[model samples]
Target: MYTIFHAVFGYFFMLLAVRVLVRRPGGQLTPFEFVIIFLIGGIAILSTIGHDPSVTNCTCAVIAVGMVHRFVAMARTRWRRLGRWMDGLPLVLLRDGQWQLDAMEGMRIEPDDVMAAAREQGLTSFSDVKYAVVERTGSISIIKR
Candidate 1:
């Protein structure tokens, strides 16, 4: 009874926090990002499971959360606006050696981050960068001139 209710409510809160806070994909997790991820999981566990520590309660919560994620994914495909809102549009941070400072600040990105991405793509300098985009997945993509 209360177990089922806790599962649904706890899962919903965890899911909402994830959507709002986590910006990068798994592969791109920096040390700071990794810490944040672990902290979020720890807190979510304390929150979602409460003090039960029962396998049945945990499994129910997992299943409920998984189903909600699946539904959101399916709906995202069917509704473009919802998709855009859930996952923001990509932002261009640099173009032709010029910086889009406002966009970088809005995304909490710095020039050095873009330069590091450009370096990954074998670009030596900003002059060689045709464009730098912060993709919706939170990875920087650099286009070379």
Candidate 2:
């Protein structure tokens, strides 16, 4: 009986909890977006495994983290200061139609990786790459110079 009760409440509240907490409410998630996802997963596990100490405790923790995440996300969008910290600064991978060999070595990314991303955008030759950048999203974007 207790197990069933917790299951129903857990499922229901988690649904309502996520709905009320996230921004862009019902939308897709990106790779970096998975960080918050894992965070909520931990909260869910805590709320369900030992719901005895009160599900309220886990619920409150989830609400608090969600609020903080929402607040940070909003501030990041409004202010460059916050955005840069969370998303990281962009890096240049190519310059003047040439690969920045030193930069690539430093970042530990290889030529093949750059070529792969470039190929996805119709670039088959190195000379065609005007600028290749590792954007804050962890994706490489290339410009044909």
lDDT of every model, 2 decimals: 0.80, 0.66
Off by over 4 Å in 2: 1-54
Candidate 2 backbone collisions, by pair: none
Model 2: weakest 10-residue lDDT segment is 19-28
Q: In order, how many clashes per candidate?
A: 0, 0
Tens digit of lDDT per residue, candidate 2, span 1-145?
4444444566556555654443222233546446766677677666555645567655654565566567767888999986775555667989886677776876556788678888999888888898888766557778887
Best by TM-score: 1
Question: What C-alpha lDDT, on a 0 to 100 scale, does residue 139 get in candidate 1?
Answer: 88
Q: Which digits, one per residue and each the tens of the lDDT, describe model 1 over residues 4-117?
A: 566667666755776577667453688887887788778766767888878888787778778877888999999999988787889899987788988888888888888889
Query: What is the lDDT for 122 in model 1?
Result: 85
TM-score on alpha carbons, each prediction: 0.87, 0.58
RMSD of 1: 2.0
